[model samples]
Target: MHDTIFDQLERDGFAVVEEFLRDAECEELVAAGLELTRHLPDAPPTVFSTTEPEQQQLKDKYFMESNDKISYFYEKDALDADGKLQLDPSISLNKVGHALHLLHPIFRCYTYSERVKALCRELRLLEPAVVQSMYIYKNPGIGGEVVPHQDISYLYTEPIPPIGFWIALQDATIQNGCLWIARGSHKSAVHRRMLRSPEDRNKCIYDRPAPVYPESSFTPVPVSKGTCILIHGNVVHRSAPNRSAASRPAYTFHVVERKGNNYSEDNWLQEGENAPFLNIYTTSQMQ
Candidate 1:
């Protein structure tokens, strides 16, 4: 199983670990997520949210609908729109993220699970420890494409070596925006480009040759709720617009080796390097 996943990742830059969590585990996670969602405030309106005529109109504009429960343990100026990087006062009371960060079995499984450790041994990344995570929820009626991009572009780590585990909380399918990877694309040299301004979000860089793969190039990673997809940090990946009748929820956690480790810096993209604190939201009444 390890070899299969390893080979797939080497060839495709990503692999799906089917049934990584049992059915009961999926149910448990969903329950925990539901409980958490009840207490979280609705997302602050984005540009599209206020301009649209209705909730469905907003969904129509972005081609997607998602309710996010963000845990912001790490804060950096990188995400700051203006010069000031302030803790969002709206989320100051959120402390439950610590529970998800340190104790969740899924988080541990992605970071230090035996299978993952063995894979790390093969990849030779055992020095620095794993250090971060974030969860995502994509509800039905959400439609948007995650444009083609490399994960390293956003994180900016030196060695550019991190792994993202996308665990499904509900069954994922092609109709529901399941992930698609460009085979053998992880070998490309890293590039750091400016974040697209709101007006230029659809732009694509064309400086380098596009990565190559077989004619049967794309692989759709579909799995039952509770399975996971392990992906390389540098892989070229994206997803289709969700057009399914059901909601497709998933949690993605990014893990990296702990700080102060010697690694490749030749192709490093200069960017933020701080460990973010966990951001949590709860709807529970204080006891």
Candidate 2:
């Protein structure tokens, strides 16, 4: 068999590897996710839209730890005009995780699975560390648009950039806002990052003037529930807002270099100089 996925990644900057997870496993994950949403009222402080007023309450609740914790992002319809979060699992939830692998056992099983590690080895990631984990629920009609950007800008490391593993927990179709990527975009250098404002501390800044790309270049990627989309860090990609009647929930995590310890301390999510980024291979949960 040809090295299809890896070959496409090298040339096109992204690849869709089919059947990465079994259908039964996908169903299990979805059910587990639904269970977690029940605790939204007591969820740890979350990082979401700055436009909402509820951010202040979350800031007050978590105090200093608010900035770095498992956050919630609700669907637009889930909130009132005043932006207060409504108390219903069906309408009021969009995403329930940032560090899900660390917070829950089910997610950790998927994150540190041998299948993921072997994929990393195929990509020649020698000492990969799991840096971030997120479960995104692209709710029906209100799933927001993700603007065109590269992953390297958000959480960066010197010498090399991280790779993103996005697994579709539901059938991702064109109607439900499947991911879109600019072919060969990873060949370009990262232009900007959404970083915390050093001065204000509360706000984030997108280094400007923003780098622009042609709109006609993007191609939609639709996959089945168990499919896995492996994304290169420098790749310019985005997804549209879901207007369809169904939801597209995806489990996404990121991995970066660890052996050389080149992960940048200045990255907004880094807690401190000595803070440890969980090692994907040897983490206690993985064991």
lDDT of 2 by residue, 151-269 (tens): 88877777777889999999999999999999999997878875556785545455654566788999999999999999988899888888999989899988887776476544556
lDDT of 1 by residue, 184-256 (tens): 7788866443332344333322234333345365677777888888888788777765557765666666555
- Which is the leading candidate under lDDT? 2
Model 2 has an lDDT value of 0.74
Candidate 1's TM-score: 0.60
Identify the candidate with maximal TM-score.
2
Query: After best superposition, candidate 1 residue 210: deviation in angstroms?
Result: 12
Estimate TM-scores for all models: 0.60, 0.86
Q: Give the TM-score of candidate 2.
A: 0.86
Model 2 residue runs over 4 Å out of place are: 42-68, 200-203, 271-275, 284-287
